[model samples]
Target: MSQIERGWDAIAQLDFDAALAIASRLLNNPHLDIRHQAYRMMGMANYRKRSVQQAIPYFEHAVQLVDNYKDRFSLCMCYALLGDMDRADRLFQNIDSLWGLPVECYVSIVMCYTEPKHFQRAVDLLEKIKLSYTLLGITDQTFLAIRGQLAFHYALDAVHYVLNMVSASFDTAKWIKSFAEEMDEEGKKSLALVSDQVCHTKGPFTINQPNSRLQYPLLCKIEDVSLFEEERILGIRVLYGKLHVG
Candidate 1:
């Protein structure tokens, strides 16, 4: 087998030191792909070993070799692991793809921060991702998977935060209304029951605490979801009053 293949085999065998040793040789390979792969392999090996700072230069070199979304995504995760969330988010936003591994990469970063101190940050990050998917018309299965992951990792509190945000957001509320309207009476009833359960389940955490103070632009963007919902409800109320007068 080629040295690269052998190196990957070593990695698969959990011999990170062996893999890194092989990666060192491949880093100077004449072939560009081999060189890039060497850097990435070193990064992954170090990342698996929790040597985040050591992993970063390898990922950074990989990105320097090929600055694609996937490369940037790898670097983003590395930054997230290093607790440089702002850098990670900036890199993620630069990646314009709406689906595929990019979404998975972003979710991986959020999931990495599932400790109690960082859990709210993860939830907030998930919320922003949900907003993106909502705007992009992503699948219900995707949404369900994300919600399930939140519940699995952080329990009901995280799920309830998402649910409450959905309850308040016009786009998500419209999704619920449209979905219910498409169903039979029994299905509608079932949805209502579930919605009631979700909406009523209060999260243990506050929305905007000191540590979770959102930055501008994105903060405004997130608030726009609620504001849009409020405006839509007000419009409905005005129309109802006019109809009653007529």
Candidate 2:
């Protein structure tokens, strides 16, 4: 196998050290694509290892070599994880072909937005994704799976926003009420859709903990299915009570 192929294999095996070592060897290669791949692999290894700060420069170098949405997305994720929302937002704006990205990519972007309390942007992106899926005439089950994931995140974000607003002294009663209703609706939708056999039986429904890397709460699946369901119900109940009580 080629050095790049071997590097990827190492990454797949969770051997970040080996992958980084192989990638470093190819960084000085004459071919631009090879160098770009090396840098990309290095970045991915570091990112997967949760050394997000160390991953940024490698991803930046990879993107400089060849500007692609995948590398740019990785870079944006690193920035978002580091709480540099400004840089992440800039990279997000520059990403092209939003409709062409995979569902996981969309989920990651939504998480990035919600991480920084940019809940409105997350909602807007989901609306856009739904419109795209409709335009593309995607399969019903596939659409439902994507919708379920989006609803979960939306409900989760709503819960977060309501809690923050309630803790603050601001007069957020109207906004809290609005989000409470929205959260309940979305939470119900999420529970129904995610529980559908067709939605969680196959595809990316079975979550795997590859390593110590951070996993998004909404993306938990399979073994955590019951936990997810309970959380959804609890969030809705808690938010409703909070809004009604005071």
Candidate 3:
């Protein structure tokens, strides 16, 4: 077998050191394609080895040689993994379309948002994924579970933002109600409890209410949100189960 094929074989076998060695040798090849492949192999090997920082330059080199979807996507993943959300977001935006990408690719993209608590973006992407699955007449239980997890996080984050007074105009109650509508029975119940708590504390006061007496109730709501810890734990357990199965 050629060295490139051998390098790929080594990567498949999880022998990252051997793959890196082979790829390193090919880096000086005369052909651009060969050099690009070498860089990609090295990047893949390092990434699989959990050497994410080491992987970036190789992926960057590959992209420099051939600025295609696959290389750019791989580089974007590296940036996301490194917690460089701005760079990753930029790369993701540059991609023309996610059509025809695998479900795992979509999941990875969602995770780029989800991991950094960018829950709204994660939820939006999940909605798009669901639409794509519907258009293609595809139904998968694993995807459904993943959707639920993402949705749960989105709801939780919305509540968190409201409780923290991060955004003045955020309609937490309205968002919770809308999210609850699409949830399963258990999910709906959980969100219902959260909604009730929010409403009870929120009372008749708007966030912009200048009344000091009303401010006390809003302050109390911050502590009230913690009362749903059991629900939060349950949701987390469900997420863990779904992720484990997937």
Candidate 4:
């Protein structure tokens, strides 16, 4: 195998010493791809070793060499871990500046929401995006197709985690009810489907349903959203299930 390949292999094997040794030599490689890989390997190795402070510089340099989406994401994650929320937020916002959001970046952003400190902001952004779609009444096939690809489970999973797992100061229940109340039938279907998927129940799967099978916001009453008891119960049961899952 090539030296860079070997370095990556070592990184995968959790041999940071060997990976660093190979990466150091390849830092000056004429090929940008090799340099990017080498730095990424080193960064990942350090990150795995819990040396996040050390990993940041490698990721930073890797992004400099090749504005690769994953590399920028790694840099953003590193900054987030380092308690530099502002820097992390800037990098995330800048993601579409060059290329549109990569599929994996959606996962990264959702994972960020798992952090307690960033949870509220992440939920706010998610709610805003979902609301924008509702406001636009984006039932267009092309838009739905693109949105499905970009979001899929990440956005819903983030919301699920916050609702079920987080102990936040913010009124999460109120927000969830508000979001559901604001969505269209299709949007409600998506939310309901995600809710069911996360809760591991087969009671209602509306994402693939016909117009006749649609339910607005699925589990809550629109006229009286104050009755979110069922959702709260489901969230509790799902949280318990999630906690015990391997």
Best by lDDT: 3
- Model 3 residue 226 CA deviation (Å) reads 39
3 against 4, candidate with superior TM-score: 3
The best candidate by TM-score is: 3
RMSD of 3: 12.7
Q: Count the backbone clashes (under 3 Å) in each candidate.
A: 0, 0, 0, 0
Candidate 4 lDDT for residue 94: 89
The alpha-carbon RMSD values of the candidates against the true structure, listed in the order shown, are 16.8, 15.0, 12.7, 15.8
After superposition, the stretches of candidate 2 with alpha carbons farther than 4 Å from their true spots are: 97-104, 135-246
Task: Please write out the lDDT profile of model 4 over residues 77-139, one tens digit for every residue.
Answer: 666555566787888888747676643344345333323455456555544455455565753
> In candidate 2, residue 168 scores what lDDT?
36
The C-alpha stretches of model 4 lying farther than 4 A from their native spots are 114-117, 124-246
Tens digits of per-residue lDDT for model 2 on 1-246?
999989877866668899999999999999999999999989987876668789989989998999877788788777766667678777776674452555445555554443425556766666667766666787544543333334344443233322221323333344323323444454444434323332223222322324312212332221111212111111111111111110
- Please identify model 3 stretches exceeding 4 Å from their true place: 97-103, 115-117, 135-137, 152-246
Q: Model 1, residue 27: what's the lDDT? A: 87
> For model 2, what is the C-alpha lDDT against the true structure?
0.55
Candidate no. 1 TM-score: 0.53
Worst 10 residues of 2 by lDDT: 230-239
